[model samples]
Target: MSLSHALLGLLIVEPRSGYELTKAFEADIGRYAWQAGHTSIYPELGKLAEAGLIEVTHEGARGSRTYAATDAGRDELRTWLLRRPQQSKVRNEDVLRMFLISALEPADAITMLRGIAQHTAAGAAELRQIRELNGPATQRGPAGFGLLAAEFGLRQFDAIHGWAQWAIEQLEATADGSQDGAAARSVG
Candidate 1:
């Protein structure tokens, strides 16, 4: 989804300063989905305001301005949410690197795959910690949605870790030059 839509969605809950929105994205929203940096977020807020989607509702110290979604903004956000989802383009550096492992030695590929598994496991653990910290919030309605996303993140990491381990085992078998190695090579 576009940053504008995401920002507008966040503002629907309550008016918040740009700093507050940045923290929300990093602390909650970024955990499971998109992450928009402060630089990007502030600019998007400006654009949303220019489009009459959001407006300054409160001003605080250091030029901080709180923004709330305007009626036009709410309408735009609702329309976008209701529309058919277009094909999403994913850009994962880790996956891209994994795909290029054919250029590396088998041992090196195995090492990389093992690292991927380790990293994924660590990430899953981190998500678990976040979930535990938000226990009460997860039991409620709006907050429960965040918990659901966290659960999905956990599942995704589990799958990635499992696949990495399986790949490592397959490579090890190939290196042994066993009959199964021939089958594995043929399948691959």
Candidate 2:
């Protein structure tokens, strides 16, 4: 999804200062969906205002401007959300790394896989804590919807952790087979 789309969606839920939105993205939305830096966000906000998609609703200290989506922005956001996306996707870094992992030495790959398993397990555990802290979602608003996304992320972590461990097992079995062959050759 486009950065503009994310900004509009966040604003639709509630008006927020640029600083607030930045923090929101840092902790929540950016983690689950799109990501943007403050530099990009400020400029995007300006562009949205110029396009009449958003407007400054409040002025805070240090020239911070709070933005809210206009009706046009809401319509645009809805249209974009409803539109079916093409099959193409932005490649994930982890997936790219996994694809390239075959280039690594077998031992190194095993080490990397172990790291992946550990990292994902930690992430999943953290998300579980968040889920417990959140209790349950009662509505489909930001808090509730965000919790849904967090759950999806938690599942993804679990799946990746399982896959990494399986890959390590496959590599270890290959090593074991190679060692047995080496010993057989020495005996012969």
Candidate 3:
């Protein structure tokens, strides 16, 4: 989800102010996936402007500038979409931290499991809300693809919740067994 490429795609659709592009990103793509902050987006736009991939026009409306993709930008975008993109490396800090927690006491691990369960539940709730907001009506006709993606997100969230519950139960059982074994050893 490179901000530069996304900005190019948006410009391809039509000329837009930076504010409008940000709004569209947050509402559509950023809602489900790919987060782009103003820092990244603005800088990318500047670079694109410098490269002549996009041009800016000032209409003297509160001194705001609008941007549109140039022919070079369109060609670049086409090349980008058609070419094979490098696979991005996934770095899940939470998952990595959880793996490291094996060094902690069993109780601490169980506590982490509880936190994960809570997070997953919250994510599921958010996904449900997104699905409700973007119902079948939103998907009808031209928006059908977006609607399908929203449904996929909902399903993914549900799966996450289910897996989280199962994981928590398993971790709790393991922690209990470990504690029981420790007690038996002390008694022996």
lDDT of each: 0.86, 0.87, 0.74
Q: Model 2 off-target regions past 4 Å?
A: 60-63, 87-90, 178-188
Off by over 4 Å in 3: 23-39, 70-75, 78-90, 137-152, 178-188
- Candidate 2 C-alpha lDDT tens digits along 1-188: 89999999889988999888899889778876778889999999999999999999888788988899999999999999999997686777988999999999999999999999999999999989989988675656666657777788899999999889878877876778775654454457
State the number of backbone clashes in model 1: 0
1 versus 2: better TM-score goes to: 2
TM-score of each: 0.79, 0.83, 0.67
Model 2 scores a TM of 0.83
- Looking at candidate 1, what is the lDDT of residue 102? 83
* RMSD of each candidate relative to the true structure: 3.7, 5.7, 6.5
lDDT of 1 by residue, 69-92 (tens): 999999999999899987778887
Q: Clash totals for all models, in order? A: 0, 0, 0
lDDT of 3 by residue, 37-105 (tens): 677777888999999999996554786679999999999999988998677887888668866977878
Give the Cα RMSD of candidate 2. 5.7
Report the candidate with higher lDDT, 1 versus 2.
Answer: 2
Ranking by lDDT: 2, 1, 3
